[model samples]
Target chain A: MSPSDFLIIPFDDWVNFLVRDWLVPNFRPIFRAMQVPISMVLKGLDDFFAFVPMVVTTLVFALLAFKYAGRGMVIFTILGFAFIDMIGLWPETMTTLSMILTSVLFCTIIGVPVGILAARSDLTWKIARPVLDIMQTIPSFVYLVPIVMLFGVGMAPGIIATIIFALSPIIRLTNLGIRNVRTDLIEASTAFGSTPMQMLFELQLPLAMRTILAGLNQTLMLALSMVVITALIGAGGLGLTVNTGLGRLDVGGATAGGVGIIILAIVLDRITQGLGEQKKVETTSLRQTLISLFKPGAPAPAHAGKAA
Target chain B: MTSKISVKNVFKIFGDKPGHALDMLKSGQSKNDIFEATGQTIGVQNAAFDVKEGQIFVVMGLSGSGKSTLVRMLNGLIRPTSGEILIDGDDIASCSPAKLREIRRQKIAMVFQHFALFPHRTIAENAAYGLKVKGVSSDERRERALLALEQVGLSSWADSLPADLSGGMQQRVGLARALATDPHVLLMDEPFGALDPLIRKEMQEELLVLQRTLKKTIVFITHDLNEALMLGDRIAIMKDGEIVQVGSAQDIVSQPANDYVAAFVADIDRGRVFTAATVAIEPSTLQLADDTAGDAVRTMEEENRSAVYVLDGEDIAGVVTYQQAAAADRDSGTSDVPIADVLITDFPTADRDTQLADLYAPASSGLPIAMTDADNRLIGVIEPEAVFAQLSADPATPDTEPQVEADQRELAPTA
Candidate 1:
């Protein structure tokens, strides 16, 4: 082994001491203390806002459908939701979904800013890049060990594993997007007296968004793959069910859970992909229709409507 | 349009602490002294010129003349290390961010040779992007974008992606994008340098048409002599990061500012460049207007004419009748008949101080137009093919030899 690998041994030992010895024993008490009051606040809304699930889910699917393939998709998404309930898997499906949601949410919060920062600063990007490379290249199975030690083999462990696997795409794409902005366009923006901040938010970021969305798509896919792997650490969801059934050699149960994960993956993938595709098409077509619509005798192709 | 851009005593040096280098240079240090003191290379050296508004001002030179860098500074893309760029009496360095944005988004627009239309967007989308970014209402932006496309004659290609367009068409799209911003000034950096010959001509005409209609202030950069001549109202010839000369097209063509400018204009076929205004006309000495045909021939031998302007009083008429000249021989006791349909190239058709080398005897007369002075007097008559004859001597044109002595002038200059 190289000297670098030798140093990694003590680093692993330190991680074990902190996570396995200190965190597992004490972290839950600290987390529970924080959650108790928030749970009470949520308990008050739980009864009155039981329909919150239906409304939020509908809005999300509806907006996604409208943006992507259209209302045809919305009808199908609604039916998909109904099937989970009819199969008596509503609560379990929701639990699996929340886990996926938490993973993606945390990934975006951590990943996007890191991506943006890397895009702007060369030194920061150079430092952040190799770390992300390591995160992506390390075995997903290996990630479960540290998270299990720290977060103690539950949904949080599943979440942490998913985050590490999914975070790389966002940062890489964000860097590429910013770098690829046209020299003339950047100069034009600067000439306009756009402050450095204004240029970042208004010009550079918007232009980079399409690339960033592609990264997000990649991240979501990686997170979905890692979710099932994390189930071996005792996270209870479709993944945990699949893992449990496999342990007991229950083919019917395992197959059903596997099928359920596929269904969820397809739906989420389609909706997010649809939104990304729509944004790309919208920005692009707006520039093009300017000339196309003006063509004398070339009958306009429905220019009055939204690009979708 | 007025004086919109003035670059005064500008110097750009590439190195650490260019300010210190400039200060040292200003404090009696030579170029080599500065080089030794600061290890700096000068990008622009004491470049001073003003671009008049609504003029197609050309800055032309070989690579490293800093024309590209100069244009960048004009548009505030780069700040000068020393000296000032004044736009409408406002120094660019003094301008605020808001002011700069106002200038970039409103007053000026730029086109690049690479046709850097956004790869992701369609032609129309790329054209309308500036307007969209500037917060023009969608309807107005779309309307203006369409108008710009129509002006560039690319309305039919609105939906096409930039990648799909031909290089010439993509340059047009780049032009359309610049036009969409409704700019007061247009900055083009060799925008047609990459096209094939035929397409380059087409784009040159396209730009001429745009300038005619828009009357926008234009700053164009190019290294091609022919293109510089075809486009610039006033040209600044650059060499080694400094302008060698700045003058009108006529001045540059006729007098030439220096040996460099002379070398730049050399090898250009002057016969084609000169029009009928270059030639002279003398009244016909042969007075036998209506004499018998045999008598006209006798007068022709007596009064030798290169190209007799067969006149019908003060107003011009036609060439001498062959039969009249043939018959003049009998009246003059001469037996020879004059050749019919001889080309009238030497008469009033040639420019004053017309170099003897460019003159050629008429091979034929098909197309004819009169040259006039500022006073509207007929100087000479020239046919369309005369210019062609001079230019077609190109050894590259294997099919045409061009017998005129003028045709060989280009080869001798190089020799």
Candidate 2:
């Protein structure tokens, strides 16, 4: 035996054996239960994207982009969508959108409450912080190994892997947002005799909405990147197009797919970022929102038009 | 009179083992000794006082002197390590969370130094916060909040957000929020401390004016001796976690309990704290309505006075100067035309609680300022000599010497 053999522990091999033999067998029922929601959401998004005509989907996105962002973003979204459609990658783009949106939905649902719980309890925060650090630091491909082992390969497993990779930002930011809520406001709420739940909903949550929305934006971006990577596991999206193009050594096709992703990322990033910007403002009047964007020196929104 | 809020032997030690620290404190260990031995910080030590109803009770101390902690304990915010805080007969130290909330909801309202306004909410909404927390209906909350805003003279800005208002106006909104709840007690923790000096003065005057009609039992906390003297009917002076003295403004300024309290008192602007009543001296003789001009002259000569109040029994009918009395005597050619003929009603009269510094303007009318009771009876008079003596006696040399010089210069032209 070589001298190096003495130091080699084979820790990874032992963990792999334990996970395959013990964890998978013992948690079969839990994994089975998780599959229901996962498949249902995946199917729902896939079918929804499939049924919508390409032109109609493009118009809807353009309209949303104009409403939240402005005229500038609307033009960008239209150009992006038209270019993707012209390149014959419209379906793949739609599937990718569906997967990213699905990941974002699940991450927000699971991350926010956990973040609030962690913020409220020091013990929970100590535990969640290290787990989040690890989740963020690990390579995205490592998550695929366990996801594939538990659920096998397909769009469902791909979606699960995207969620695992993207969930860290939302949880971490939500915890930070809640923790950073002004101590003065909290004391004021307590002095005014708010119930614990009332303090959470009326005071803490409203104040933290901007930071949490920023977290959501980060999560969305992460999920977008991870969805492309998940294409290696039979997930159908622009990632597949890019992957196939790369396999055949077709640089033109790969470049086209990369352009489509850049367009989509820009559109999605602008929309989520615009949502965060809107929260900094007190007024929700469409006229004011439009006016303020162009005229930086304009007065703030009039009266109490804050979104109740 | 029954005390509205009574704090008895209250102690607040902040640390992991506050109970052990409290036991050590009770066993006659000093705050520093306990802190050194057990790593516990004493927030307040053996603080005992009574806040009477409708009285402005000020707790004044420098930062880290435990004044804020003591006020917070009254509302059950900082739970005392030992002893009792009784608000209207209920011990707040032993209150459960719900009961404590109820007390805060219905009995006490606190105004913070930073205003603590919700930046996202409208001024009306901020004003109505307390009412909303008490589960008042929206319509009623709106109406009451508007009325409170009106009281603070901010009705026009109700729809504006807190960010839109200036700092002083925002603090007014904070006051309006507390008033909207209509609680019996107001706990103001240096509410005007963040304001500009001019605005701070205006808010202090505004609070005093509001107190006149509101009659809320106000426990005001401040690091300013001037503010404490200005606002408080009774002042409690704290130092290093212990209440060294508790009394009226006069009591604190005149008779500080120890050297620490004396140092605090020394920094006080005494002209502001000592009112006309505190410095006024009783007249030796008065001109009666029936007293003839000759009789008035004899009394003035005996007392060596330039002027005297003409009394209608206990009421101040008017003032009769020696010149006016002498001219009347010469014109009438007798001392018996009645003192009413020479009685001059144009002289300035001051109330007992009027600050001595304010007496300058009224006293500048070249008249001895008469101190009057609520019934307008002449109680005493403030002479230039008495005013200068008190001014020069002030331990705060900077505030006194200049003011005395100015007063001397202002009178020099007249003299």
For model 1, what TM-score does chain A reach?
A: 0.75
Residue B336 in model 1: lDDT? 38
> For residue A216, what is the lDDT in candidate 1?
81
lDDT of 1 by residue, B1-415 (tens): 3578887888878888798888876676666678887898667777777777788889888888888888887777877788888877878755775677678787888888788777666778778877876878978987889899999888877877776678888888889888898887788989989888999998998899879889888899998878887788777778766777676543455556556667777766555344333333344323224433344444545554323444434444444544445445456564533332221223334444343235443324433444444454454655445545543443222112212122112211110
C-alpha lDDT values of all predictions:
0.69, 0.85
Question: Largest TM-score belongs to which candidate?
Answer: 2
True contacts kept of each: 0.29, 0.49
Q: State the lDDT of candidate 2 residue by residue for A12-125, as single tens digits.
A: 999898889888888867876786787788789989988999889889989889877899999988888998999998888888998899899999999999999999999999
lDDT of 1 by residue, A115-166 (tens): 8788788999989989989999999887677666555655665666788888
Which has the greatest DockQ? 2
Docking class of 2: acceptable
